[model samples]
Target chain A: MKKLSFAALAGLLATPSAAFAQEAGGIDQAVNEVFAAVTGPFVNLIFAPLPGTSFPWIVLWLVVAASIFTLYFGFIQFRAFKHAIQLVKGDYSDPKDAGEVSHFQALATALSGTVGLGNIAGVAVAVGIGGPGATFWMILAGLLGMASKFTECTLGVKYRNEYPDGTVSGGPMYYISKGFIERKVPGGKIMAILFSIFCILGALGGGNMFQANQAHAQISGILGDYPGWITGVIFAGVVFAVIVGGIKSIARVTEKVVPFMGVLYVVAALVIIAANYQQIGWAFGQIFEGAFTGLGIAGGFVGALIQGFKRAAFSNEAGVGSAAIAHSAVRTKEPITEGFVSLLEPFIDTVVICTMTALVITISGQLMVDPATGNYLMDGNMIQTVGGTSGVALTSAAFASAFSWFPYVLAIAVVLFAFSTMISWSYYGLKAWTYLFGESKRAELTFKVVFCVFVVIGAAASLGPVIDFSDAAIFAMAVVNIAALYVLMPIVKKELNSYLSRLKSGEIKRFKG
Target chain B: MTTSIVVGLDGDGSGMRALDFAKKLAKGMGTCELILVYVIEWSPYSFQTAEENAVRHKRREEEIEAALERVVTPSVAALKKEGFSARGIVRHGDVADLLNTVAVEEGADQIVVARSSEGGFVKRVFGTATANLVMHATVPVTVVG
Candidate 1:
């Protein structure tokens, strides 16, 4: 089994990745190589041609998306921030809102979509590679991603499709494809179709499979001696049972789980951090220094910054089109309501949660063990695990150093965090599947089955290589999503300005359903 | 083919009301195998797993037994200490579907739950768990106000 995974990884990599890594051997070098294979060349061969060529070009496209939307919608993220709060406070819970969930429900749903392994495992990767510096960039990217989320979710509400049955379906796929068709863009139909295809694939890889795999890994780590496939089969069965029932089940679970787990993990991380109160100053010093000083195992300032940004971008997933699908299902007359609540996701995931992960690891004093200082030999260096394991266990070790009970507590936290995340992603991927493949029971079942299989794959295999590749796919979704949002920025801007006007006029009146 | 009536108990919001009503309904059903369920909202803070983060897969089964004893037994006992044949099931994810799943598992005829809604107008138009369940459930769900 190990041989097959390595071989499959080799075949996947021999195509483009291994050689690229040879050319660039910094900490992120291996990660970048895997990403290179996924973003354009490999995916294009399997599917269709992607729009951009270079990394900078990809960044440019996203900037264009933010700019066009900001100008067109008159900077909705800023204007709507205030009203978004009122909306979150329950100002617009009208059943006539043409969606299956309330605004808070939608925001919680979307948050469940974005806040997952990325925060925990993803942050671990950044800090492991970038040292403490990655936390800074991760926080910055999370804040900016808020605006992108605001723009995309606002678009989700405006362009949402209300079926005669009160079942609503919307996302980047709907807004980009359906909205473009209404506007009559040249080859807009093809663009929309292509975007839908990418979304479904992205959903399968990043949202569904990735979630199951990470959750399985966390569970296996905590329980010990369990069959990976058994976890997969049982998880699939449970997810199948929930998903087969559709969005209501998904909403019910996420609303409760997201808040509870989110608070739980944060408080636990804080507990560990607080115990090391004397080291707090040094921890920040190391993080800021590592950000610019190349203080990690990567051996360069730029490398640490890039890894941090990449992981943060991957973690919070603010710019990606995934959150839009979750937010799109919200029940609100106003699009901005869901968008405002959506802003909290990045703060929770990247700024707060991601920071906690970094601090716990850093404060645990396992990061940069200067054998010279004889302090503890970590130094942001990627220590190779003899057997395949990463993420929560590593965070666990850090906490255990400060608090004896942390190992067990952290393990339990990881499993639940991973479980809730995987279930939520299953919903996102299913929606994407339904969007592109036609809503058939077979399509849904097949996707669910494959997703379950991948969970086992994620658990059994070493996380580093495959997750590196999968992380790229998650970012690739951003490339496509930002492009669509750029073109549809006007719709987002218009929604923003209108909401601001309403807020200024005191029209929102009261808050609560 | 034992006739079973399953009632979902949530400790939060209007769940207390749901449990009380389900107990009354069970009494009326007479021969029904009453099943009481309580979902612990995911909290990093818990007395049971106080120092722990998640309910272990095995422990969840244990939690089902224990919660049945602790929360349900006393509550059920209060209904004139009904000496009815009853069991409990505990699930880990979302409340609405878990209740729906338990209903299907126990072959429940009716599901009773309390409505949790945030906004006033939205609550009326949507009616919380009742509205959501009606849209998605394969069985009739009677939500306690």
Candidate 2:
């Protein structure tokens, strides 16, 4: 009976793509059918259009939450930006502090998860659709998003459950339930459950599958069309090896890979931007002009605003709360210091990395502008669209214009980014899963195996709608997480004020000047 | 006269070599107590968020337990089996600093550690704990290769 059930499960999993692989069209159609059936209504509901406009309410939800946090914290993102850098530098870190990873390692781990294809492909899509003006909004959204990261991460560490074995289980579930109960809020437990459910789903979809899918896309773009399952199997194996060892192994890998890949990508972008130094002014002008004036696109200013805000929110993921999980594992008694360090994440990701990508794409002359209307031409006539562009391909074309060898470098970067993101998500998902199922070896293994399998499915299958649903699931996490954040902000404020006062009084000594 | 000798162990082959040397030295010294300490190189100065920091004590305890169980205890037992007086402890901190601290705290007459194979650029750039202890330790440090 066990064998029969296993075989049946195998067949069920394989039928969608494997059975129809002989006929690519049939497989794509079937995938689309199932995808549309499952994700269509769900996506519509989450990204429901704003009144009399095509802008997604979810995007507005994130924007407003970020704006509110910025105001409530008195723009702490800007005020504490310098201090955040110092925190990351370990200037005030005491060696006797109790923690697993350092603040820098925690930030690196979180940044790896956030700084993947979203910065590359997501930015390209935003720029392609919203024009250069989208970059301005993306930067603005990133700036505002820092405060959200600060609030959520602070609370994450404040209420985390440290096990007897010295391992930590934390994130929105712990914070929402614990923080709310402390404040005598009624729905804390239910909110925690809801957040956990969404977190697990988001981890599998956005964190695992989406990364696998994009890595496969980039590989095929370079290595010719081979089955995605091949990529999937390889990815699953590597991810399993790293994640099975738990956070230490994952942290060690991410701390190295994240920084290396980040620097490599940034240096390359800087080189391209510097080479086009003359056009730097022109690019900034186009960005500013398009940001407010909208380049006469169909949605105009609102459309650009939506795209820019959406990409930035998606890229930095301030209020989404996944970062809190990664940051919570930092070894510090003062949780507020982590909050300060986390604010740097969005800055480095969107403000620095994403901006570099935008500049490269803008200055590469890949985006064609109609001189008469002073608007971008989107009829697929630009050099970036040679192979029918949008997303990572467009970004690749932009870079390749400066260096012919850039496509190969980009392929490597994409794979490393995908690998780092998948492992980090595995931890996030496992924490949420354990929260619901009760933490045990069996439960952890179950989640890890299931996560690895999805990595394969993500690579092999052409389920666009499934990925869309997963993306929506990620935003759904933001909804629940931000609600909890609102209630928990007061606690965060108390911590922040106490920490700042301590700093002023020299109570928090600098171990290193 | 019970002479106390501090021996550092890293749970590696080199550490065992040092342990063997210390055991021989303690035997030659007639009546002696071998204070075996395994120091796990840990930096508390790294920046950590609250969650990782919360479990710091727990992890340190676990590290001490593992070091005692997997490394120090077995060695101490074997030494005792050989009719030598020995005790084991595990700690988390800089190896040289902790070794010196443990030596002084135990009131040991001398300290012994294996010469790490790590040399050349690594030794110059990031000096080994043995070299540091030899220079800075209050007690006499015996470098056993």
Candidate 1 residue-wise lDDT, A215-255, digit = tens: 66667666776544466557666655555544445435544
Model 1 misplaced stretches (Cα beyond 4 Å): A1-82, A92-100, A245-258, A296-299, A369-390, A440-446, A449-472, A511-513, B1-145
Lowest summed lDDT window (length 10), candidate 1 chain A: A93-102
lDDT of 1 by residue, B17-118 (tens): 877687777678777676776764332121111001111223445656676677766666664355677766655544665677678867888887776645
Model 1, position A116, has a per-residue lDDT of 65
Candidate 1's TM-score reads 0.65
Rate residue B90 of model 2 by lDDT. 78
Q: List per-candidate RMSD values in Å.
A: 13.7, 4.9
**Two-chain DockQ for each candidate model:** 0.03, 0.23
Off by over 4 Å in 2: A1-12, A15-20, A23-31, A244-255, A296-298, A371-374, A380-388, B1-60, B69-114, B119-145
Q: lDDT per residue, candidate 2, B73-144, as tens digits?
A: 999999999999999977676889989988998889999999987778889987988888888999999998
Against the true structure, candidate 1 has what lDDT?
0.62
| Candidate achieving the largest lDDT | 2
